[model samples]
Target: MSQFSTPLATTPGIMLVRVGQAGCALRWDAQAACWRWPDPQGGQLYAWPAQDSMPSGVRLLESAGLIACCRSGRVLLGLGKRLGSVELPAAGQSGRPLQAQVLATIDAAEARTVISDGRTDRQGNFVFGTANTGADQRPIGSFYQYSTRHGLRRLALPVVVAARSIAFSVDGARMYFADATRGDIMQCAYDAERAKVSDVRTFASVPAPAPERGAAVVDGAGMLWSVQGGALARYDADGHPRQRIELVREPVASMAFGGPDLRQLLLLGARGGLYGLPAGVAEELAPGVADTPFDDGPAAVVDSQRPHHGD
Candidate 1:
């Protein structure tokens, strides 16, 4: 068994949006509830512990604070607060339940990885991407820029490309995302203040394609950190490789800086659970808060009443 298995006994307070293993959990529901899993036969209501098998097998997760796309076409937002048993609509034509609306829809086939770019400016502009499955699957999807007034718009890249892990500069001036299909980190300059984009370039490339959905972080030292299979890779401000350290196992797709000083490196591994490692220089991250469009709440706590793998 993996080291991650034992820690489950002591629950962490923060809620996370977990995917792969069980199923995708969403927070868009009332008080941040989740669907057990999607029905294989296309049934409306899924059982609590969805019997269907998922691709990633419960590894990828995000800090439960915003909305994300799940494996089965479900959009989830974390409540942050613990509310008793909550209920959600069986997947269907039923309109999404939330104050924020979906300005654009990147065909279900293209979108598997999604991130909230915090929020738009006074003009209401935002950026989002879909994961690149592969050429046999989907060549390269589009990175979209949406606005309440103009509606679904595309951020023209030199070519049509799909990006997995995405982040915005602290000022939200430029957008950074990874091409998991090609193993290169990329950036696009955005005059988010004016809702414009220009100057697209490859930031960095890895030795291997990042698995399903890779995770990345821009540290205070102005370095880029991304996860390959089982290692934490670092890049300079210009995207030059700095260093990489191998962790225990192949990671699914989640990373965060925790510990009292926010220095401890946290990893979410595929099939295993959460793992922690140490890095030399402790760094603080300048959070990209303004990029997010909606403020759901503090983030909902995990609902224990729901069924899953034995606790």
Candidate 2:
């Protein structure tokens, strides 16, 4: 395999994408055609489009911009020219306080590590887990599906709670996610037609349960990869980790697979850093290929929305 190495370069525009204190999630939103973030402000969402000039609230925004989820629990588009905050009529509540917003809420309370992927299903459905962050925080995170047909419907997945990571299969039929507490990746047999989830089985699990586990993505091929401890681990279709590549930096935060050719895997390391590794078809590291520089954004997101007290 051809291994490529180079000093990571810095991207100045990246810093402009900072929306929250601590940036938690980043997804390419196809609807508004921009990048989105669950801002530190509990009830608010933010977004920016690719390569737009800096906006007010954002310190260093991503070239792709930032989108925040609003106090009403609706996501606000912040990137490019798609600058407007709107509400997702379907977002519900975990009945938790706004002292710590959604990201922390997901970290403490929710079992699964989930954020909006920016794209709904063929039927326009999405699922998010609630963060439960206390000694009594249960892994039993809730799942919701949004569509015009039945509006927002919550599915009762037998709570196996852990810091969970979620992703849809290439076909969007099978749902794959990770249970960080148990260090196992799981596949939930999902019925998109009926909007039901069942047949939960362990697809893969980490050898050691790493804290602050980040996002996951499936390549053009049916492969899985995750970032932890400033390194990237590749998993086979069976959810078994085949190889782990350590990063020069510690505490890798997030990762994305993008390039003109889609051969480069872009890793978002904590402390405002980015690393590139040739993944999938470009599995061979290109010699002398330098790590891409990254700009820093927020420190940590704070929950501001009040919890649903239940009427």
Candidate 3:
């Protein structure tokens, strides 16, 4: 009883690659021509050459967390409640392990909280969220932003059980955040210059029976590509549900857009594997949309509503 027209494993457009034990925080490091991600539960960071299937791994500071490539060629890592940076070893330094330098740390107080998801904004600032890691997984996690100019600051969103899937609109005027516990994706007006987010409202609500949401990315046409369980869903700028791409049986931990034109959709499977869909699939899903735009515009506020995903 799936909405997809064809079985995911049988689709010619999709390709799969095994990468790790549980791949998350997938990102494209354009400057280095490589893809980066972390095995949050495995305490490992990984980098794969853009054109090769082999991946290099490094021990991380935290037992598990997320990672984002920074503008300085180093990677920003969100481990537990601390944010740090690490430089990937040079080509010939494969024998040496990379190390993380802690830049900022957050005291979770008595609760056992850890960083869950992270991404870099258009302005080169790193934004990430934290979640309670206790047995009950309480709704005490919060969102934060970090930059060299302003340091680290928390956002004004209500505490949630867990936060995942952080993304920005094509023009960077809107920011999308997903609360995995509530199965809701929220959008807010983002001001990159001032590094502020406001007018938080629900954008889409995933239907019941779906797994908790995972990582997400925005396409050139302003559509949000979000992963949940073993499928990827597309939502238009207004939060209208569009197409859905069925992936492997395992949950998709994260994803990134890469390739020379940035149309290749790279998926990180929770089982520590990498998968991809040809650029043509992305072009078909987001036709006429251009890459991230620099022009700034006023943020739009829309009433929260659940997008209709037909049965």
Candidate 4:
């Protein structure tokens, strides 16, 4: 559609939101009313209000919740009610480490791999996968889903070298993920209750670049959007190419859809780089997809006040 061609330009009511380093896991924290992303290089979290400017400075994530990591294991900062509290330094600052509670320990098996990408499924379970950190960077990583109710359960998906673009269809029936090294994105029927998947098949073969494969997102209409090489592209529910939006510079690291209406797409990158997103609704696109917020329901949150161990 014409609207899909350039829906990410500066139309109106949309401003460029500058963010911090290797911005991975970009998502909206409804509880805090801000856009949140992780600093992949720094191992910290940064938060910026939905309407804030660069001069306003970003707030770091300081919650008593869980942010699952690779080597460090599942971090228990506290979740549930106190989801988006900010207490770290402002933007540009490295920030200090929080008093953490480790729910699980990183064993020797994970020493050669790292949880490369992760996201919350529609039913609120954290689905993440690891990538081999070996010299050759083999695709031998496994996938797992985590929740407070069932703890952490490994998925039956194939072992990907580095799992990226972990997202889910709006209805939660379809799970989307990719390993760019393998040359295409994949999907399968996901069962939240059983923590399993079926009918795994090639969803698309978009050929995204390395490292930049850290994220992708499903819009309200159940469409899949991700960085294709250096360009941003959107695909239909059946994994057909819809629109491939080019950027002045290729995507930096990752991206996510935030904002109250869920149309505000934020593109994140390394070294505080800024990217453009949909500023206003296009006439051709009509009244927008579903007008829903990017809420993954509750997440794999843990109590932050628990005893600290296995740091």
Put down candidate 3 lDDT per residue, 1-311, tens digits, no spaces.
Answer: 43233334323235455656777777777777777788867778887875555777887656546777665577777767677677766776754455667767764454487778867777766667777788987788777766665566676666777788788777778888977767578988887656667898888865666467878888877888887665677777777767766654566667777766776777777778777766566556443222222111222312111111111
Better of 1 and 2 by lDDT: 2
TM-score of each: 0.53, 0.57, 0.83, 0.71
Better of 2 and 3 by TM-score: 3
Of the two candidates 1 and 3, the one with more favorable TM-score, higher being better, is: 3
Best model number under TM-score = 3
Candidate 3 wrongly placed segments (more than 4 Å): 1-13, 278-283, 287-311
RMSD of 3: 8.1
Candidate 1 accuracy as lDDT: 0.41
Candidate RMSDs in order: 13.3, 11.6, 8.1, 7.9
Name the best candidate (by lDDT).
3
Residue-level lDDT for 209 in candidate 4? 44
| Candidate 2: residue 34 lDDT (0-100) | 40
Q: Each prediction's Cα lDDT score?
A: 0.41, 0.43, 0.68, 0.55
Estimate candidate 2's RMSD in Å. Answer: 11.6
At residue 142, give the lDDT of candidate 3.
75
Better by lDDT, candidate 3 or 1: 3
lDDT of 2 by residue, 19-88 (tens): 3344445544434444444443333333444445431223222222233333234443322211233333
Candidate 4 lDDT (Cα, 0 to 1): 0.55
